[model samples]
Target: MPSIHKNIFTIAVVAFLFRLLMFFFVFEHSERTIRPDTPSYVRPAINMTEGHGFSGNEHPPFFPSAIRTPIYPVFIAFFYTVFERDVLIIAFVQIFIDTLTAVLIYIWGRRLFSESAARLGGLIYSLSVEQAVHAVFILTESLFTLFFLWAIIAVSCYREHCRLRWLVSGGILIGIAILIRPIALFFPLIGLLFIWMASPNMRWQFMRHGIIFLLIIAGIVVPWVIRNYLTLGLLKVSSISSYNLLFYNAASLSTDLHRISQAQARAAINDQVTKELTALGWKGDELHSAQLYTAWSRKILFSAPIRYVYIHLKNDINCFLPDVTDFLELIGATQGGKETLSVLNQHGLIAAVNHYFDDNIWLLWAVFPFIALLGVTYLGTILGISIQILQKHWDSLRLLFLPAAYLTLLPGAAATPRFRVPAMPYICLLAGIGIAKSIQCYKIRQQQRTPI
Candidate 1:
């Protein structure tokens, strides 16, 4: 066991080193100096350091707050205060946080699974060029992923121990995470399910725990809600839904060639979109602009729900496929590459292929098979465990389903391999179980082969 753990530690170290090297070499050269959303965050961080509140004006406070989370910009702000402003320092700090996230993955895995499985998860995550590449940019995904995983680990610890403090701490952390990325609101629901699973026999006890947990989460989130209300003069539950509705509706329209050709027509259509959002209670010039840019998107969904669903289904399929974008672009397909991919591909085919391969090797091989196997393993594990708690069946499974459902549902709307990163840890846990079971079977077969 000691040797096994040592080996796992070695693997984790090597994986971290490799990721660091890649970040310095390949990613440094190929990645954009500024990410698509960098300005939205960096400007806010600067403003905050200069005594402004967490207001970016271009985006909600959550995104800017992300810059403050993980304490990166705080450190950067200190340096700027002492000497001068240097954005590169923040970028380097982000890389450090990104690496720290890999370490956290290993720690979380080791606690949840065996050292070997933890090592495997760390190895996969550390060497993940997709994650490495993303780390180079000043994007929220890396930091969001770190906090999100930390929340999961904290909640899982609470599940194992049934400690109210851990549960409350997990709620606070998740609330903070939601402030960084509003999508994390699903976590509280997931937590409720977990509480039910932990206290199956005591029905009132389960509800009591759940209600307390939710109240704790609300305590953390309410301040942000108040801030938004005061700032916008309207109660907004989440800043993302309006943005999502706009983006999804707009992106869905890109599937039509005729729509793609008429740029002027689309521009006019987008103006109507702003009018619609204004009618829907969306406010602010920035919000109005995003709505206008994506107005044509409404046509795709509102025009034909069934057809839009069918098109999204096809998109989900293509998201998993290995085909390159230039091939699609050559044929005049409008749906292939978005801004990130277009920027990556501007250099040439080699750069494009490298980017695709780095970001999606898991999609090319691991994710699909793991997803297929996940259904079986998750069901088998849940059923096997739930059988032990048959008296509390609903409580046992609800926590797992709510978060899992939210995680699964998001990918269908914007199907990309990168979008699936948050769920990979869970998938890794399932895959680890399946692999262990296969090894146990092999061990039994070998034992049977021994001569009497």
Candidate 2:
């Protein structure tokens, strides 16, 4: 086999086996695989396959849902129909998709940097604890990551070749990704910016291409918006954004102000919203309720705007923290979250450290490797980005850095390592470049020291 083909094959095998092992380990502890939101996805999927249409009402009448998007649930529904509603089957499919994503990361690295960098990037992504754990869970992260990766790769291709076809492909992939997870809603705008930056001299030409790219994304997404309008009477792609704003974003802010737990703040806000709605003679419909939630959330979030911004930016930092619980939870090393982010949110950073050692001191040996890998990756990313900045490597920044920053920042206070999955490919690629560059620098220094 050619060297490139051999490297790709090796990466694929390692990724497959690693994810497969993690899946089996989770299978042995099946309860750990199910999360609070698992039912939201799985139940709607099963409802679809059972002829109830796309609903997650969890009761008779099975009303159509406007909260979650269609593609991911439909993706799940197809698997449930074929595989008899087996979670393991769904996990296996995710593992296969994630493996492809890992290989694509290698391709992304090769395009941006060197052969060795791509190989290393692919390996780092494959062995990621976050990637492995989320692959086995009944969540959108794994599948969304695949589409997200392709979408970004398509953008890079368009940047290099300035081809209309690449824009169309990227639009389609990003549209699919948005359907799977609404967090990608603003990414198309970023794509346009990247295009504009890529060919600054050809402003008018790139602008035309940018508009066409956006139109393709709109064409893909508008049907879903129309469906939502006709069915729910709401002109929104998904109601999840409102739900997150109320429960997560607002709740986090409330927690900081009230000095109460997030759960308590959520309950309090729920009661307050319910009372206000009742007082206003609310009809208790999904559309009006979502509108109310968004309004109330914005009110609360903006009431203490400075504090909310502080909390949002502070938690953005949490995106990079290593959470070994992804593995430890499956292997039964710990129960619930004693993660640094969780404790830090509740009791501050000092307390978070104390709590980690206090509760799971014995697991330090297992956790160290994940933390070390995280540190190394971040160090490498810093180096890689530094080099790019020094060289004025705008393509690398546009392709990798912007998306990473956008994905990392957009999650706000809800940021977690799981939320970091979409950004991992770019980060790993940058780390690979940094490592490769550092080695080259070291070799040069060594040669200079040696006798001629």
List the candidate 1 regions with Cα displacement exceeding 4 Å. 1-8, 26-33, 57-84, 237-240, 253-271, 274-303, 309-405, 411-413, 440-452
* Candidate 1 TM-score, true structure as reference: 0.69
Please provide, for model 2 over 9-56, each residue's C-alpha lDDT reduced to its tens digit, 9 standing for 90 to 100.
Answer: 999999999899888887766677777778889888988888888888
Could you tell me which 10 consecutive residues in candidate 2 have the lowest summed lDDT? 334-343
Pairs of residues clashing in candidate 2: none
User: TM-score: which candidate is best?
Assistant: 2
lDDT of 1 by residue, 191-232 (tens): 776666565576566677678778887897787666655655
